[model samples]
Target: MADQPEEVRRLLEAIDALAAIEDDATCASAVTALLNDWPTHHARLREIRQERVLALRDSGRTWKEIGDLLGGVHASRAQQIAKGLRGTKRPVKGADE
Candidate 1:
């Protein structure tokens, strides 16, 4: 991070947040820098997110449960990823799943 401009470092952390929420200036800056550093990783990261969601979903874990297991990502984010991976149907609704 030292090599990064001060603005860049702070934005990287901010972008990580935006990835899970909505985007804004900080996220845009961070994303620009991150892509400069690791363009190839985008696809890889997406694939992994999809894979993680699928693995946990197929194992019968709820979105909330998977999120908890996945270092505290929001349950909604977990649900979307998992549902996307499932390809046909979304993950079961409610905590009952």
Candidate 2:
């Protein structure tokens, strides 16, 4: 589609190339390598997204606007992300407490 990002297109092409591999062993090895490297790739993606969010905020976009742009998260949640706060997990409670 015309709206698809170039990076996404390239990723799809890479997946296609992987799917086209003929040798089972080679394909398995390639998949294994990708799995091993995924955490680094995922972290880089998070960094890029956070950078963009900060840039948007610096450009005077409101938290609500940023949240809408970020696929409908709440304004406070957007602000938390922009401020580098990790999402909080609820503490597990003991039954006796």
Q: What is the TM-score of each candidate against the true structure?
A: 0.44, 0.74
lDDT tens readout by residue for model 1, 1-97: 8877697699787666768655577667766787787757766767787887888889899888988876787788788776564335666788574
Task: List lDDT for all candidates, in order.
Answer: 0.75, 0.88
Provide the RMSD of all predictions against the true structure, rounded to 1 decimal: 11.8, 4.1
**Model 1 TM-score, 2 decimals:** 0.44
Global lDDT of model 2: 0.88
Give per-residue CA lDDT, model 2, range 24-61, as digits (tens): 99999998999899999987877787889999999999
Deviating ranges (above 4 Å) for candidate 2 = 85-97
Error of 2 at 24 (Å): 1.5
Task: Mark the regions of model 1 whose C-alpha exceeds 4 Å error after superposition.
Answer: 1-37, 83-97
